[model samples]
Target: MSRKAHSFLHEYPRIRVDRFTESRERVPDFLLPPRCRAGAAKRQDEDEDDDEPGPWDDLDQDDESTLKANGGVRFFPAPTIQLLSHIHADHIEGLSAPLRSSAPIYCSAATKEMLMRLESQKSREKGACRVPMGEGARKRPYEWLRVTAKHAKAKKKFTGLAPAPRDLLHALPFNTPTELRYSPGVNIRITLLDANHMSGSTMFLIEGHRGAVLHMGDCRAETWWIEA
Candidate 1:
């Protein structure tokens, strides 16, 4: 729920946002909960493993109630930000519902350490999840661990609360420029070139006040991206 301070991370800047919530309201539910481990049944082998679908799958609830009574003020807006141009497997097929919202998932610190090692290998194939491993006290070489929930949050019959992939994972460093104020009319300013189309690939260049966008996520040619 935190992590939006710039100043190159230090000397003071994250004075707030320990809990960000501005109603990102993005619901085109990619349902995945029938006691997961890919169980939900009916999906037909995940629709033949499709990948050619973008724009959050589906949504047109009266066009989001007319952009929530007209604040999306025209054109394209309400889908704040989520640019993960690497970690292929057909680019993370249907990202389970944008990896469970609170959106802010840029990428590339080796794709956030390969999404924290694929959430610790889905917590060792969950058997109700429990990855208890510690002891680095005076000689630390391994520490970050959180695949918790022997009974996931006091169990309400659980519905997906075991992925702590470094919270909303924002890494972006390839090109620089990074301000992403999620609300107040969604100010942008992303930048992540270097999409040689592989290891930690990236491409988005997006600018501000609903203006520019370069999203070429699957590139190949080089030479500084053909002189950018």
Candidate 2:
């Protein structure tokens, strides 16, 4: 019964492909998922047992192929800031050494801890020293700004991970709207909210001269801790 209901919910949308396409056309600025672009590599490995095709396989060839391809982080040439919503591998895939070293990354404290742990583990596997060192010897690949809830308590110091530059990690309390002064008399106000997805997931509300945009990272409408 569950399988049938799932199939119905999934396949019913495809049955009205024409209406969906028309609706999509009305929103010109809408961003397409990474996989919808042409030349996107299949994420599944051949060794996996499941062989079922995905629901989107039936999309029109042209519609699926023509969208501009995007990486994990969208790049704007002028006055660009990188906001990391979470620490999921998929969201952080394009955060290579070059990109990490070049830009400032804004994320939550929990996400930062996860990233540091992952990096530390990799360094250990590579035969690098596991002992935490000073900023000059062992700094994060990028400048990390931690956004935390206002009511949340201060995090305990973690000594297992490598040390990040003291100047690199800045913690911003939630509910306190902060302004990023990009230029003289020009700034952007940003607020953070609990995402209800996982530990440290966040939703960002950005306001500037142009307009306000709420970027919701991977979030769940119903929190996991709530009783169903």
Candidate 3:
């Protein structure tokens, strides 16, 4: 008898702050907390008597699932699908140009709009001649990352992977349960919850035959919010 393959959730190692100093600077200010930018000298000393946890200290670390989200780079054999919780550049960095996969990318409608705007800005900065849309005119954004010819050639030589198609973007509605066929016999249900961290930020709940997992992507949890 053949044994069933074990499935588990995976996450890429967190990037060290010092390693991406320059890149981190470009991240939007609203995405970072006040303490994250304050130097050691500017930080207030912790009160020994005050044992209360800070705002960002509360987090649930235990969860299980076969589905992966916001971790496209670490999948060696490539994932069948990708889930994007928000439009934050850091979370989507791995989906950048030159590294391609055919997996369908899922995200919120607001996130898709923001990505399209960002891409349009990038195109204009590259001196690409484009006409401004008239009133009520809209252009659909490409789903894949845009790579230069030089980077594309280098990527092809090093990793023989094809570029991810820009047409595979899917937008999910908040709080709606979406069914996904993960494998031949496995089915997963995904629900997107508002994270309240930023515009279009989301928390993913993935439930499968094995177990369920809640993946919080950059969420700001409040006591009241949790108790409710």
Candidate 4:
């Protein structure tokens, strides 16, 4: 379920978490115990006629609550360069302050748009005015800003997906490898592969002295790009 790539035998040079899912399809819905169903049926009968909708109109309410309470994430190992596919909470909740303190993030234009939309909605709900996005996630709130600060202080660069070719200057150079000095005489190379799953979802191709690894975040195996 998890894989790692290390180029050298060094102290914490770099580690990449690969492939959150085999594909971008929905996982199985959680199934409650039979007792829950029985209890719901009883409550339904008492609250409304058999033909009426049950009091618990949505069985997945608990699931959604659990996700939100848990920051709406299904966390996998973190990636060196994360390419988000969409703005779904489950796909992105882990992108909170703590998680982002570790690595630079990349995503598709559509995905960023969706995330901005959600942030705008949250701002409206909290009665906060919307602020413009910065050059990268660095300009974002706590998690993003902190992470960006760390990279900036270290003279590291953070890249993001561009909505258009015009956005290229503002975006992180995609499909390029950057050298990281994890430790003395230890270095690593990280490359990005476009994952068609979402606007900016990506598959990582990491090469090091140890070995080469490819990680698909949420991608179609049969995609034509795979052949290309």
Candidate 5:
């Protein structure tokens, strides 16, 4: 098995469709605590005597799936699952499955609303799936992490091995940008872009050591006219 990547120190081999697979890196220590820690002193004082554990206790374990759900931060891998907007199965089918409960599924606030509306319409029409004449059958948007796993079988002679079906860590956020956050020191950064094609459509800009990649999700680019 490959080793974990260290924080701010590149070690893990690049992950690609045709590249070798490796374990995820540890969440960097510096970025573990929230920025508002100092203001919570009184809250901390009250909790000091309580029997219940604190947030950091949960964070120390370094579970990406859990972190994304409860909070918006996580140390994820490449090929993170990004749900752009509510659409048909072809658009959402291959995305990640649910992870630890209560995770934030990232999307524009409008997209979230659109999904609920779609669900309701589905129930009313008793539609098995997307129905004709239905508007914006888009569902909620969420960010997910895809972890690597070993393939069913491996050949003895090769140093490189194939990975099995990806393990997903789902993160669903009710809002966008501000609600969006990530664990520090990771090579990957995901940013959501507006996909003007639909009411709540979005595009994703993924940046990493490999390079910057822009993925368009049902986007209809607009041509703006400037008169000067």
Candidate 6:
């Protein structure tokens, strides 16, 4: 069965796609991301299996494409801050671009701990988003072809996993509110509430001068979220 969801939540959800599995780990034989640190020539052997499953292989549509259709993260310019609810691959499509940018990323402490387990953000793309991500539902052409263990070892520069930069990741406390002073006039109060979806799953309660908006990033609950 697919993972349970906070189906009623229609507010600001980061990832809107309904998933086939609870998390990225459920995909069997999950290979490294279908990306290379540098561009490579297309596969030489005609018989070579280019369809090998990568981390997001199981996903039919990608988050960025969904974002493009739904009109959110991918289309909007750099947000005030980046917030990650969890480390699931679906929630992280088009992730490399944000990681490469200077925008700070915020999440619960658990999410930060797990970022190390994800593919390293170091990549070949240059300058501030010279090429936009989410151009393809699957891997971008530059992020083309799955990086198998054999391919990774053969390609000396491909290190699938590495430590996220400390300065870029921000861990916020659940329940307690934190203030983001973007400018003298632009300030926002953000509070993280437990979504009870997973170890670090959360919903964002963002309050500004105009109003309060709750962003429920992929979650699976009905009511207790408001109590948080």
- Over 66-160, each residue of candidate 5 has an lDDT whose tens digit, in order, gives 65563534442442223435444434432334443232244565655544344433444646543554333333232223323432233222436
> What are the Cα lDDT values of the candidates?
0.47, 0.44, 0.50, 0.41, 0.40, 0.49
lDDT per residue (tens digit) for residues 1-228 in model 6: 133442211222222322222222221111223231112234555333445433232233336556456432222122335667776766554444423345456788887666543433332242234555442222332121123454445445545553332345678999998987633455677898887888887788877653577877677876665455
Candidate 4 lDDT over 128-157, as tens digits, reads 444553434232432232224345444443
State candidate 4's TM-score. 0.40
> Which tens-of-lDDT digit does each residue in 21-110 have in candidate 2?
111211111122444333446565443423444333323334222344432222212222445666666555434333333334566777
Instruction: Tell me, by TM-score, which candidate is best.
Output: 3
Off by over 4 Å in 1: 1-105, 108-110, 113-115, 118-166, 170-181, 187-194, 210-221, 224-228
Regions of model 2 farther than 4 Å from truth: 1-75, 100-103, 120-169, 223-228
**TM-score for each predicted model, relative to the true structure:** 0.26, 0.44, 0.49, 0.40, 0.35, 0.45
Candidate 6 TM-score to native: 0.45
**Model 5 spans > 4 angstroms off:** 1-81, 94-105, 120-122, 126-187, 225-228
- In candidate 3, which residue pairs get closer than 3 Å at backbone N, Cα or C atoms, i.e. clash? 144-166
Models ranked on lDDT: 3, 6, 1, 2, 4, 5
lDDT of 2: 0.44
lDDT of 1 by residue, 1-228 (tens): 112211111111111111222333322123212222122334545553344433322222236456457543222223345557776555544343333344555777887676555533344445235545432112211112223444345333456444443455678798887887744444567788887877788876766543565767577987776887
Better of 3 and 4 by lDDT: 3
Give the clashing pairs for model 1.
none
Per residue, candidate 3 scores C-alpha lDDT tens digits across 72-141 of 1111233455677776666654443433455566778887777655554544544455656542233323
Q: Candidate 1 lDDT (Cα, whole model)? A: 0.47
Q: What range of 10 consecutive residues in model 3 has the weakest lDDT sum?
A: 12-21
Ranking according to TM-score, highest score first: 3, 6, 2, 4, 5, 1
